[model samples]
Structure formats: C-alpha cells, structure tokens
Target chain A: MTGKAHCYKRDHINTDEIIPARYLNMDREADLAQHAMEDIDPEFVKKINQGDFIIAGEDFGCGSSREHAVWALRGAGVRAVIADTFARIFYRNCVNNGFLAIECPGISQQVDSGDELEIDIEKGIIKNRTKGDQYTFQPITGFAREVIGAGGLLNYIAGKVV
Target chain B: MGATITEKILAAHCGRTQVNPGELINAEIDVIMCHDVTTTPAIDMLTDRGLSRVAHPERVVVIPDHFVPNKDIKSAEMVAKIRRWAKEQGIDKFYELGRHGVCHALLPEQGYVRPGITIVCGDSHTCTHGALGAFSTGIGSTDLAATLATGKLWFKVPETILFRLNGKLGKGVYAKDVILEIIRQIGVDGALYKAMEFTGELIDELSVEARMTICNMAIEAGGKSGIINPDQKTINYVEAHTAEPFKIFKSDSDAEYCRIVEINVTDLEPLVAFPHLPSNGKPVWQVGEIPVDQAYIGSCTNGRIEDLRVAAEILKNRQVAKNTRMIVVPATTNIWKQANQEGLLDIFMAAGAAVSTPTCGACLGGHMGILAAGERCISSTNRNFIGRMGSPQSEVYLASPATVAASAVAGKIADPRNYM
Candidate 1:
C-alpha cells in the first residue's frame, strides 16, 4: 500500500474530536465517515483524499478511549497515522480496527504537509519520497504487525483463530 | 536489578525475569473489556473479521454503561447490538441498565480484577481497576479486538514516576483534591505516557474507596496508570468483596522510580478544577463566590457510598439554591440501595435535589443535566473540557461531592467545610 503522507501537526487529538459523541448514534461507516474530524476542524472531511496520512505531536488521542476515533480515521481514507507518541488506548484501537498507527519518535518534525512520502510499515521505514529522506521506526511486534497487515486485529484473528 | 512495581508486574505476567521501558513486549492479558459507547463498534469490527467465538469468553467482559435506559433510538440500537452479541457469544456476565454502574466500579466489585494481573479495557478510566494492584490500563478498539481474539497484548513497558503523599488531608479535602493538586503542579502533560506509583503516609490513612478515587483520575495526569501498593485497606476491601484470596504485591523499598513527587496534604484546603481542564485547580477559596446554575454529584470519579454520605451529611437541614438546580445520581444500584437504606436519599430529596437513577448521564453531556448555553455547573465528575458537559458555551467546575453538595445548598460554589 502506498500514499502521500498528508501530515497535520497537532496534539491532544482526542476521541471526541475524531468522532464527536453526537454522531456516535450513527453506526454505518458511510454516515459516520462524513462527520470525521468535524469537531476539530469543520472542513477536514473536505480537505483530504484517500491514502493520506496524519503526523501528530505528543499524546495523540489523549482522552476517551473510544474506538470510533480509529473508525473515523479509517473511514476518512487515512491509511496510517505517524505520531511522536499516542495514548495507549488510541494506539491499540488503530491496530485492532485495521488502521496503521505507527509510533515514530520525532516523526512530527521529519515532514510537513505536501511532503510526499511512502510508509513501508513492514520494512519499518518511512521513505520521504519527496525529499529522499528515510527514517527508521520501532516496528510493532510480529503479531501486531500481522494484525494490521491483515487489515486489523479482528480480521487477523479471523484468519488465525477462525 | 530492582524493578518498579509496574515493571515487576509486567515481567511476572509476561513470564520474563526483567523488562525494560520502551521495549516491545507482548504480555498475556487476564481480562479484556469494552463498554456501550465503544463496544458496539468493537463487536462490529470483530464480526467483520469473521470471528465466531472469543478465545477466552470468561476473560472478556462487555458492559453497556454509557447510554443505559436509551436516551435516543440510536443509543438503543447500539445497545441492542451489544445485547444480541453477548447472548450469542454466551457471555455470562452482562450488566443491563440498572445492573450497570460504571465499568471501572463494577469490575472490581464483581471480583473480575485481581492484583498482579494485567487488564486492558476500551475506556481510559480502566486504570481505576489498577487500585487492586493489577496492571490495568485502557486500550483502543483495535487492540481490544486483537486481545479478544488472541488473549494477548504487545506493549513497550513504560517507566514509572513515583508520587508520595504525606500528612493527613484537612477538613473537606479529599482524594479528588489531592489528584487535582498533583495535576496542578505537574501540568496536564506532566507524566505523559508514564506510570505513577503513589506511596507515602497519607495513602495509609485513606480508605480503599478514597484510594480508588485517587487512582481513577491518574489518567488525567497523562500517566498510563496510577497505583498504590496493596495494604491492609486494599486487602480488607478485597476480602469484604470476594471469597477468593487475591495475590498482593508491593514495590520493593529498593525499587527504582524515575522521579518522586512529594506532597504534604496537611495544609491542603478544598480544591476545584475550573472548566476546560482537570489541572486548572485552585483552593476552593481562590475560586471565591463563583455562582453556579447547577450542581452534580456522580460519575466514576466520586460516586461511591462514602461520597454520597459526605454529600448527604452536608445537605441535611438545608435546601438547594433557589436559582440553582442540583442532581444527585448514585454510581451503582448497590450504592443507591445503601443510600436509601441509610436515608441519604431522603436528605437529597428533602434538600430539593433531584435524585436520578444510576447512569453516566451528563458526565459526557450525553443526557440529563446537560448545561444550556452560557450555563455553569459544579460537578463531581472528571473532565471539564469545553462542551464536555453540554454546549460549548456551558462550563463545568470539577470538585469533590462535598463541594458539589455544599454548593447545591448555597446556590453557588461554596466550600464544604464552611457548612460542615
């Protein structure tokens, strides 16, 4: 999978902002997808295309361990989220739901918006296709990587256990 | 080499002799949990992945606490999905509306948590269970799904920062105040992604309920989890609730802590976290005569029996402010029953306070007592983020139950000690 890493350098991107509690009533992916990031930036839904990424500062997804945050990101066409750090809950939610959330220390500073990039998660390297910059990250465990590789924990578990 | 309590527990559970912070380690999880607000999506994702049965049914817990009694059709449908999923999965433990309180409170009370065990849930407040000496923390839906399927989790163990409290809390001061004070000193990002191990004389003086209150808010400080070593109070609490003996573990005197924060509680007065931030705390008096449109005393943070007692005692022989509305909700049915049996409910009712059924109502601005535009309310719940309690224009002031109850009577924010 390849995409231009569309980076937004913001921190404390809580679950509430990812998918506001108001739209939690809607469960369908399409309906919920339209409201993604409506709380944080009203126009975020209109700003990006599929396969874009988000790079954030510290404590991303800091409040409310709601999985909707991951769902909203996945639904919004975000393929991966590279951040300096993530709230434990948010990080796990991403992998469980099949979205790629990578923790690369100082990743927020390595790139800016419009900086074309290729994230080879399996190789544990983020190739800045635009600047020809390559950064190595602490790869998730084989199991976690496999889970995300298979499109999330549920999908991974289905293949392995079911 | 000596290990912090967090490191030791992770090592013991994961079967490693020693583990270092920031190293990827996949540890076995004893319990995996999710609740209403998050569980429906989790179940959907789990099913979409084609899982038929949980790897360990008994180890997985699903509670529908957030929107119980169904405020709207959407919430009802979400809960309906969970109910059907629970039944089909043969899930033995499912708490319905009245049966559910907060997931954090219900887990320990039902003996699902024990010390030295590693627990993960889909709610940040899952750290509350760590008060039992377990390594409990919150995980996201993606992680919860993996845990449900494999019954294991990968983690880079976090380093710990120790917080030692000394001296006794002064009148009307409480664990909520202590936590707020700590957050004030450390700022919101103070312990980002770190564990907080609380030790010291003041902890010994606190009841287990009070300690749970302290640990419950540890997440607000940006810590992975906050825990106190199990002592007599902790043991007694476990004993009173469970027939099964739980293993107790304590931090070695020689354990290494990254940094230790020492706090003297003797001089503390009542504290309040103003709207939009948990750490925006100041002495109750420092807030000076702040008026309130409402007062609320409930939530996972400070909704226990003792919390109720404190509020009820202060409300007796008084009435809520003529212009202000006050709502008192028991955290659980058991706490509600105990208050009824002890006549605490009478005090609340006689004081012109509206007593509601146990729900997470208005804590996240999901239901009853939601503030109208430009309104302000003093609450015993955690979090005061903008629009957290209702409209973005509305404000929430976080305080202990005593302060909420006392303020309910005075029709403005007032210190509980003044009335006590």
Candidate 2:
C-alpha cells in the first residue's frame, strides 16, 4: 500500500481525540467520517484523501473500546495507521475491522507530515518516498494477518465456517 | 511448567491441559457483556452479514447503562433498539435502565462473574472482573459480534508481570493511590500486552471493591488484564451473591514472571492523577490547593458501597463548598438501595450534594453534571484525559472517593487525611 502520511506527533492519542464521545450516537459510518480527528485536529478531514495513512506515537487509541475510532478513520479513507504501539483492544479492533495498524519503532521521527510512503505488508518494509529513507518493521504475523487479508475477522470466519 | 492464574483459566476454557504465553488459542467465553453504546453497531454488523440468531443467547448479558436516561433523543432510540433486540433474542440477562448499573460493577454484584473463567465485554473496564480471578478483557464491537455469533474468540496468552505490594497502607492511602503510584512508576504502556498479577499482603488485605478499582485502571497502564488469585474473600463474595459453581486457580509460588515490580505502600499518601493522563500522578500534598468547580464520586471504578461509605464519612455534617457542586452516583441499583437503607444517601443529600441514580453519568462526559469550558473537577472515576468530563478546555483531577469528598468540602483539591 502507498499513501501520504498525516502525522500526529504526540503519544497516547486516545480515542476521545480520534473521535469524541459526543458523536458516538451517530450509527452511520458516513456521519462519523465528517468528525474524524475533529477534536484533535479540526481540519483533519479536509487534509485527508483516499488511502492516506495516520502516523502517531506510542499507545495510539489508548482510551475507550469504542470501535467508532476505527470506523471513523476507515470511513475517512484511511488505508492504515502506523504507530509506535497501540492499546490492546484498539489493536484488536483494527484487525477485526480490516483497518490495518502497523507498529514501527521510531516511526514518528522518520516520517514527516505529507511525506509519501509505501508499505508492503508481506515484505514488512516501509519506504519513505519524500526523504528517500527506508525502515523495516515486523509485519502482522500468524492468524491476525490472515484475518486482515480476508478483509476482516467476520469474513475470515465466514470462509472457515462454511 | 506451572501456569499463572490467567493462563490456567484460559487453558481450561480452551479445553486444553496447558497453554503458554504467546500461544494463540480459541477459548469459550463464560459471559459476554454488551452495553447500549456498542450494541447498535454490533447488531448492524450482524444484520449486514445476513446472520440471524445469536449463537448462545443465554451466555450474553446486555446492560443499558452508558447513556441511560438517554442523554438525547438518539440515545433514547438506541436504548429502545437494544431493548427490542435483547427481548427478541430471549436474552434474560438484559437489564434495562434503573434495574442494573454499570456493566462492570453489575456483573460481579449479580454473580455473573466468577473465578477461573474466561469472560469478554465490549468495554475496557471489563478487566474489573479479574478482581475475582476471572480472565477478562475488553474487545471492540466487531469482536463482540463475532462472539455473539460464536461463543468463542481467539486470544494470545499474555506473559505475566507480577506486582508485589508490601507494607501496610497509612491513613487515607487507599488502593486508588497504590495503583496510581504504580502507573506513575511505569509509564502508560509499561505493561503493554501483559497480565499484571497483583500480589502480596496489602493486596490480600484490600476489599473486593478496592481490588476492582485497581483492576479497573489496569488498562491505563496498557495491560491486557489485571488479576489477583482468588482468595477466601473472593469466594465468600461470590457465594453471597449466587450459588453458581466456579473454579479457582492460582499461580505457583515458583512460577516464572516476565518481570516483577515491588511496590511499598507504608508511606504512600492519597495520590491524584493530574489532567491529560492517568500516568501523570502526584501525591495529594504536592498538588497544592487547586480550586475545583465540581467534585464527582462515581463510576465503575469507585462507586461501590464501600466507596459511598468513605464519602459519607467525610461529608457527614458539613456541606459541600458553595462554589463547588458535588455529584455522587452509586455504581449499581443494588448499591443504591443498600446506601439508602444505610442512610448514606441521606448524609450526601443533607450535605448539599446531588445524589444521582446508578449510571456512568459524567464519568465519560456522557451526561448529568458535565463540566463547562474552563471548569475543573476532582473526580473519583478513572481516566483524567483531556475532554473526558465535558468541554475540551475543562480539566479533571482523578482521586479516591474520600479525596473527592474532602475536596468538595474545601472547594479545592484537599487531602482526605485532614477530614479523616
């Protein structure tokens, strides 16, 4: 996957900032997309495009188990999220929702905002197109990768169950 | 090799004799908790997939406490939708508003949680069940939907980090302070993807309510779950609530741990987590006299009967400060009834504090006593993140119920030792 980076340089960017609690009442995915990252960056929606990536520091999605955080980001055409680490539940939600989340050590320092990057899930390499830098990260392995490859856990399970 | 409590429980649920850390296994879930906030999305996902009928309706427990009393019309409609779906599915454990309280608190009180079982809930505070020795953790709605369709989910056996707390707690130094100190020592992600098994004499001496409070905030440290081996106190508490059969498991004395953290509580004072992060903790004495506009005492974290008693003891005859508004909420309807029976509610009402019904009101900035812009609140609830209690510009200080009550009386962040 190749995309432009939308960098959020801080650590522990909790779900409350990714998508605030007030918008949780909206059941539709499209309605949630409009408010993605509104709390942390009001102009985030305007800056994002299809297949863009979110670069964050450690413990991304640290608060709340609301899947709206994933839904909103996915709805806003986010291809994947690259962070130093992610909260356990949020990491699982990303896999189940087929929203890819990559754990790259010192990723925030390597990629600048608007820097173009290419991610090869199978190769486990992230190449920075703007800075001409290359970094290697551990790709999603084992059953988790299979789930994401099938587009989601439900789809993966459906294939196995039938 | 001897297994930790969490490993044993997960192995048992997986129909295996033994399991190791990092091994993936499919485990049967003993209970599944779904709240109103996540139910609509889960149901929508299930419908979109053309799947009808939940796999095991009997194993699913539904509670509508997050936005109960419906903060707005949309929230009301969501609750009604949950009611209709739960009723149609014949999920007898579904507790409507006014019947149940926060799902995390209500589960243990209603005997739905027990030791040596694997449980999953759609809320992060599900780790609170680990206080009873259950292997519980939170999952998102998609995972909840998967669990609803099949009474099983995959789990990675997490490595254990033993936290050995020693010494005795001083006056006004509660379990909240101990956990906050631990979080302060280890940054927010210190125990990422690991089980935090609390041990030692101090933890054994803590009440089940205090244990729950400690386990409830384990997520704040990025733990998969916080657990304590089931003891007589746990068994007795579970037995008093229900006659359901349960298993008990304990980690071997010589079991290996990825890391062991030693914490001493003898000199620990009441601690408060400053704004923006739970990891940003300091002793109450060092926080100075920061004025507060509101003081809240409730949430699944510290809204139990014992917590209410602590608050009532501090607010007995004195009224809350004129500049401060105090909101006290009991965790469960049963807790509310017991507090009223014991006259704790009368003491709070007489102290000029507004006592609310059993709900997670204002804890997640849901409703009821939300702070306005630039306002500051001292809360007994977990998580003091920015915009957690209301406006983004508002601030919150996290403390114990006793500290919250004392601060309410002083209109500032005050130490509970003076009032005690």
Candidate 3:
C-alpha cells in the first residue's frame, strides 16, 4: 500500500490509550475507530489519512487484551503497524483482525511524520519512498503470514473450510 | 525422551503422543471461564453461531466479579444478562454477587481446575491456573466465543523459555518482587508468544498463593503462559480442598528449553513498574518521592489472604499518610471472613484505610475508587496501563502489596524496606 506514514514517535503505547475502556459500549468496529488515540493525542484521528502506517518503539500495545483496539486501528484506515515489538495480546488481536503487525525493531529511527513510505509485506522489505532509504525485515511466521494473507483468523478458517 | 509438566499437559490435551513447538493443535478444554465484563460479548458470538447446546455445560464457569454489587445500572444489566444466559445455557457453576469471587481464586479453590488439563478463559489472567501445572492462557473474545461454542481451542505450541531462580529471598522481598524483577529483565514484549517455565529451589520455597502471583503476571511479560511443575505443594493444595483425584505432571531432567534466564534471589531487591507500563521498572531504592494520591491493594494479582496478612502486619500499629487514601479489597468473601476473624480488618481500619468488600472494585476503574483527573495511585494490581485505575489524566504505579501499604503510610512512593 502507498501512503504517507503517519508515525507515532512514542514507546509503550498501551491498549487503553489506543482505545479506552470507556468506549467498550460501542459494539461496532467503525464507531470505535473515530475515538482511537483520543486518549493520548486528541488530534490523531484528524491527522491520519487513509492507508497510513504506524511505526512505534518498544512494547507497543501493552495492556488489556481488548479487541476493540484492533477494530479502532482498522476503522481508522490503518493498513499496517510496524513496531520494535508488540504485546502478545495486541499481536494476536492484530492477526485475528487482519491488520499487519510487523516486527521491524528499530524502525522508529528511520522515518519522520508525513514521510511518505511504502511497506511490502510480500517482499519482506520497507522502502522509505521519500528518503530513498530502504530496510529489510524477516517475514512473519508461516501461520501468521497465512492468517494475515487470508484477512483474519475467521476468514482463514472459513477459507480453509471452503 | 520424557516431557516436562507443560509438555505432558499439552500432549494430553492435544490427544497426541508428542507435541512440538510451532505445531498447530486443537485441544480439549477442561474448563471454560468468563467474567461479567467480557462474558456478554462471548455469549453474543456463541448465540450467533446457532449454538443451542454447549459441548460440556458443567465444565463452564461464569462469575460476576468486576462489579460485584452491580456498581451502576449498566453494570447491573450486564451481570444480570450473564446470570440469565448462564442459566439458559445450562451452566451449573454460576457465582453471583456475595457468592462469587475472583475467577482465578474461585477456579482452583472450587477444584474445577486440575493439573494435566487445558483451560481457556476470556480473561488474560487465566494463566494464573498454570501454577498448578495446567496448560492455560488468555484468549480474545472471538476465540473465546469459539471455545464456548465448542469446548476446545487451537494453539501453536510455543517454544519453552526456562526461568531458574535459586537461593533464598531476602526479608520483605516476595514472589511479587520476583515477578517485577523478571518483567524488568524481559521487557514487556521480550517473551511474546513464548511459554515461560519457572524452576529451581525458589519455586519449591514459594507458597501456592505466591506461585499464583508469579504465573499471573506472565501475561505482562507477553508470554503465552507461565507454569511451574506440580509437586507436593500442588498435591496438598488439591487434596485439601478437593475430593476428586488428580494426575500431576513434572518436568523431565533432560527436557529442552529455548532460552534459560537465571536469577539469584538472595541479592534481589523489591522492584516497581512505574506509571504507564508494567515493564517500565526500576529498583525500589532508586524511586524516591513519587507521591501517590491513592494506594490500593487488591486484584487477582495480590488479593489473596496471605497478601492481606502481609499488608495487615505492616499496618497494625501505624497510621496511613494523611493525604493518601489506602483501599484494601479482599479477593473473596471467604478471605474477608478470615481476615475479620484474625482481626486484620480492625488493624487496617485503625490505620485509616478503607476496607472494601470482595470485588475487583477499582482494578479497571469500573466502579469504586476510580481516580479523578491528574491523580496518581500506587497499586498492587497487575498492569499499570494508562487509565487502568480510572481517568486518562491519572497515572498508576504497579508494585507489591508491601510497597503499596508502605507508600500509603509514607504518603509518597516508598519501598517496603523503609517500613520493615
């Protein structure tokens, strides 16, 4: 996907910050996305464009294993999340919800906000389409790759059954 | 080629002779658990799948713990729905307010959880049962809904990480501290999707409550589960409360481990996870003058009778800091009664601490003790994630019960050593 990378230059962006527990009442995925990151940075949703990638520092998505966090990101049109590392629950939620959670440890140092970038999960490379800098990362595991490729766990299971 | 307790349990659940890391397997779930807060969603999904009958109705447990007395009309409606759903679904083990306790405490105490079985719960603290040598982990609502419809779960057998702690723990340093130090070493995500097996003399020395505390925070380290091999402690605990027999599992001497992290507990000091992250930690001595507006000691992490006893011992003859509000909530009604009989409640009351009933009152800021804007709290609960204890403007510092009690007395974030 091609888009301006709306990077969040912070560490330990917990689930509560991504989607607060107060919004748990909203059952729909799309409604939850409108308030995503409202707890940390109120302007997050307004500044975000479609198909932006989130690059974070260590321990991203640490906290409660609420699936709404993934829904919020997906609703906000987040295509991929490349972080140094992810909390296990958040990683699983991302995989189950079809959002790409890439492990590009130390990728936070490479780009700035509004820096146009392109991430190719199939090619196992991220090109800094703006700075002319490119980096390689190990591909997601075979099972995780398949799940992401299939759009989600439920989708993957459905596809497998079909 | 013998297997460790974890491997044996996984194999038994997987219905296989041998199980390897990274292999996907569907396993029989011995117990399916849900609380009031998360049960509604799982139930909706289960009903959506046209599931008229549960695979094993008696094996499922529903507990209304988050808002025990139904904090508000909304909380009341949520719990009432769960109780009604459980009855309709033919689940026999439904514990309502006054009868219910924390899911982790009620599970093993009721003898529903035994070794050599796989358990799945909608809550992340489900791994707390792994202290008894069961293969258990938390699942998302979608996966939980699937498990509810069909009493099974799919898992990718993870490589095992070994943690070996030897020597004796110093005074005022307990299992809570040990877990905090472990989180400090293996950042929050270091052990993502890996199994952590605790072994060594220290494991033998720790009590069941202490062991549960260690395994409970395995989620904080980003591990699938934390487990210890069942031994005499496990046997005794099961035998004392349960009449049913159990088949325990132990680790083999030659079982392979992905990585081994060793620690010498004798020299270790109490640790704290500062505001905003469970893995953001430093030694207790290094943290100075971080004031706390509230001090809470409860939750599945440190809400047991033993933990309450330790806090009561420290608060017996002292008064709390005038500015700090200390709240103590027992894990269960039985624990509350036991503390009452032992005069622990009086000790806390005399020290100007509010003793709440058995509920997960303020752990998630769902009800009582919710922090106002810009307030700070030092608590013994798991996860200091933002807005965990209430307002987004507030900050939470995670620590041991002793440290929390001490901080309450000092008005600032003080380690247990200063009081001891």
Candidate 4:
C-alpha cells in the first residue's frame, strides 16, 4: 500500500488528542471521523483524503485504551500509521480494529511531511518514495497477523467458534 | 529455567507446565469487566457478530460507573441498554449504578479478583488488579467481545522489568510520589509491552491499598501490567472478602529481568506531574507557587480509603481556599460508606469541599469537576495530559491526595509537608 505521509513530528501522541473525550459518546464511526485529530491539528480532517498515512515520532498513540482512537483514524481514511514505537494498548487496538500500525525506528527523521511512501506489509519494508530510501521493520506475525488478516479479532473469533 | 511472577501466572492460567517471554498463548480468563463507557460499544460488537451467549456469563462483571447518575439522556439510554443486555444474558455479576463503584476498585473490593489469575477489562486501568499478583491487563472492545464469546484470549508473554524499591518513606511522601518519580526517571514509554514487577523492602511494608495505588498507574509508564508478589497483607485482605481458593506465585530467585532499577524513597518528598504528561514530574519543593482553580482527590489511582484519610487529615478544621474549588470522590461505595462512618466526609464538608459518588468523573473530563479555559487544577488522578480535565488551555498537576488537599487549602500548589 502507498500513501502520502502527514507527519506529526512529536512524541507521545495520546488518544485524547486523537479523539477527544467530548466526542466519545457517539456510537457510529462516521460520527467520530470529523473530530479525529482535531485537538492536535484543527484542520487534520480537511488535509487528507483516502489512503493517507500518519507518520509520527516515538510513543505514538499513548494514554487510554479507547478504541475510538483507532476507529476515528480508520474512518478518516487513514490506511496506516507509521511511528518509531507505539504504546502497547494502542498497538493492539490498531491490529484488533483492522487498521495497520507500523513501527520503524528513526522513521520520522528520514521522511518529511507530505512525502510519498510505500509499504509492503507482508514483506515488512517501508519505502520512502520521495527520498528513494527503504527501511525494514518488524511485520505483524503469527496469530496477530492472522487476526488482522481476518479484519480484526471479531471476525477471527467468529471463524474459530463457528 | 526460572520464571518471573508474570510468567508463572500466565503459565498457570494457560494450563501449561511452563512458558517464557515472547511465547504466544491463549489463556483462560478468571474475570472480564466492562464499564458504562465501553459496555455500549462492546455489547454492540458482540450482538453484531451474532453472538447470543457469553462463554462464561458468571465470570463477566459489568459496572456502570463512568457516567453513572446518567449525565444526559444519551448516557442514560446507554446504561439502560447495558442493563437490558446483562439481564437478557443472565449476568448476575453486573453491578448497576449506586450498587457498585468504579470497575477497577469494585473488582478487588467485591472478591472478583484473586491472585495468580488472569483478568481482562475494557478499561486501561485493569492493571490495578495486578496489585493482587494477578496477570491483569486491558483490552479493546473487540478483544473484550472475543473474550466474552470464548472465555479466552491470546497473549504474548512479555519481558519483565523489576523495580526494586527500598528504604523508608519520608513524611508526606506517598506511593503516588514514588510512582511519579519512577515515571519521571523512565520516560512514558520506557517499559512498553513489558511487565513491571515491583519488589523490595518498601513494597513489602506498604499496605495493599498503597500497592494498588502503585500498580494502578503502571500503564502511565507504558507497562503492560504491574505486579507485586502476594504477601501476608494481600492474603489477609483477600481472605476477608473471599473464601475461594487462589494460588500465590513468586519469581524464581534467578529469574531473568530485562532491566532492574532501584529507587530509594527514604528522603523522597511529595511530587507533582506537570501539565500534558505524567512523565513531566517535579518535586513539590522545586515547583514554584502556581495557583490552582480546582483540586480533585479521586480516581482508580488514588481514591482508596487511605487516600481519603490522608486528605481528611490535612483538611481537618481547615477551610479550603475561597478562590479554589475542591471535589473529593471515593473510589468505591464501600470506601464512601467507610469515610462517612468515620466522619471523614463530615470533615470534608466542614472544610468546604464537595464529596461526590464513586465515578471516574472529571479524571477523563467526563463530568463532575470539568475546568474552564485557562483554568488550572491540582488533581490526584493519574494523567495530566493536555485537555485531559477540560479545555486544552487549562492545566492539570497530578500529585498524591495529601498534596491535592494541601493545595486546595492553600489555593495553589502547596507542599503537603507544610500541612503535615
């Protein structure tokens, strides 16, 4: 998959900023889409289209196990998120919600905001198309990959139980 | 090979004779909890997947504490739906509003959590149960649905970090200060995906409540869970509430740890985490006199009985600052009842503080004591992230209950030592 990077060059981006608490009462993903990342970047929704990526520094998606953070990002047409590292619960939430979350150390330093990037999920390679450089990352493997391949844990469990 | 406490617990629950770090296994869960905020979404996902029955309905506990007393009609409807679902599912463990407290505190108080078991919840602070030596961690709504459907979930055995705490705590220094200092030393993500096993002389000397306070905020430092080996204090506390049998596991003497760090709390003082991050910790003496508009003393982190007593002691016969508003929330109804019976609630009332029911109110900026733009608050809650308590322009300083109470009385970020 390929997308243009929307870089937020900061560390420890928490879920509260990804989707504020005031908007958490909603039940629909579409209702949460507009407010996604608005706390950190007010025009975040207007700056992106389908199949975009969020490139961030270390400790991305920290604080709170609110899955609404992932839902909001997915609904905003973000295909994947690339960060130096992710908070544990957020990484699991990303995989469980059928959204791609990649961790590439020193990735933020290599690519600029709006840089074109290509990712090969199966091969675990990230290509900065704009910089003409490639980096290898640890791919989601084993049961985690299987769960994500089935479009989240719900479908994986449905298949297993049935 | 020797195993850590977490490995021992996971192995026991998975029915495996042995396991190690990085080994993926599906372990049976002893309890699963969902609160008001996440229950609606979890129920929706479960029903959408065409699942009608929970694998072990009796093991599932639902508590409506997040938006209890129903903030509005929408919240009321959400609570109603969960109540209906619990009834339809015959989930007798469900605790409705006013019947229970916050999910994290209520679980342990009601004997739902035991040592050497695995617990999963939809809330992030599920690590609080690890204080009892359980392998507890938080999961998402989808994972909650899967566990509800199957009674088991996948887990990657995590490497362990041993925090060896030693020395006697100084006057006004608290478990909250120790934990905040740990977070300050090791940035927010220092222990990502790792189990934090707290051991040492100081931890053994602390009450179970204080241990719970320490473990509850392990998630703030990016730990998957925080644990302390169950000692006589834990046994005595659990025995009073539960007759059910439970195992007590310990790390092997030679067990390998990813890293071992020692923190000596002999001369530690009260600490306050600055705005926007828990890692931005500063000793109370170092932080200058900053004014505060509000002071809140409650959350899964520091809303236990001991926390209340500390606050009560500081506020006794002293009025809160006229310019500052203070709200105190017990972590559980049991704690509230005990505080009221002990006249602690009376002390707070006389001190011009508002005592509210047990909820995660205002901690997540949901309700009760939200701040206005450019306002500042001194809170005992865990996180002090930007906009966490209200407007992004507002600031939150996190400290122990004593520090919060003292700050309330002084109308600013005052040192708890002064009040002591």
What value does the lDDT take at residue B254 in candidate 3?
88
TM-scores of all models?
0.90, 0.99, 0.93, 0.98
Clashes of each: 5, 0, 0, 0
- TM-score for chain B of each model, two decimals: 0.98, 0.99, 0.98, 0.99
lDDT, model 4, position B349: 95
lDDT of 3 at A43: 92
Q: Rank the candidates by TM-score, best first.
A: 2, 4, 3, 1
Docking class of 1: medium
Residue pairs of candidate 3 with colliding backbone atoms: none
Recovered native contacts, candidate 1: 0.65
| Candidate 4 residue spans exceeding 4 A from truth | none
Candidate 4's docking class is medium
| Candidate 2 lDDT, B255-324, residue by residue in tens | 7799999988999999999998999999898998799999999999999999999999999999999999
Quantify all predictions' global Cα lDDT against the true fold. 0.82, 0.91, 0.83, 0.90
> Which candidate, 2 or 3, would have the higher DockQ against the true structure?
2
Tens digit per residue, CA lDDT, model 4, B1-420: 799999998998889988989999889998989887777888888888898688898899998887777887887888899899989998988886667798888999999888898999988889999999899998888888889889998889999999999999999999999999999999889889999999999999999999999999999999999999999999999998899999999999999999999989998889999988999989898899799999999999999999999999999999999999999999899999999999999999999999999988899988899889999999999998878988878899999999999999999999999998
DockQ of 4: 0.78
Name every residue pair that clashes in candidate 2. none
Which of the two, 1 or 4, has more lDDT?
4
The window of 10 residues in a row where model 4 chain B has the poorest summed lDDT is: B94-103
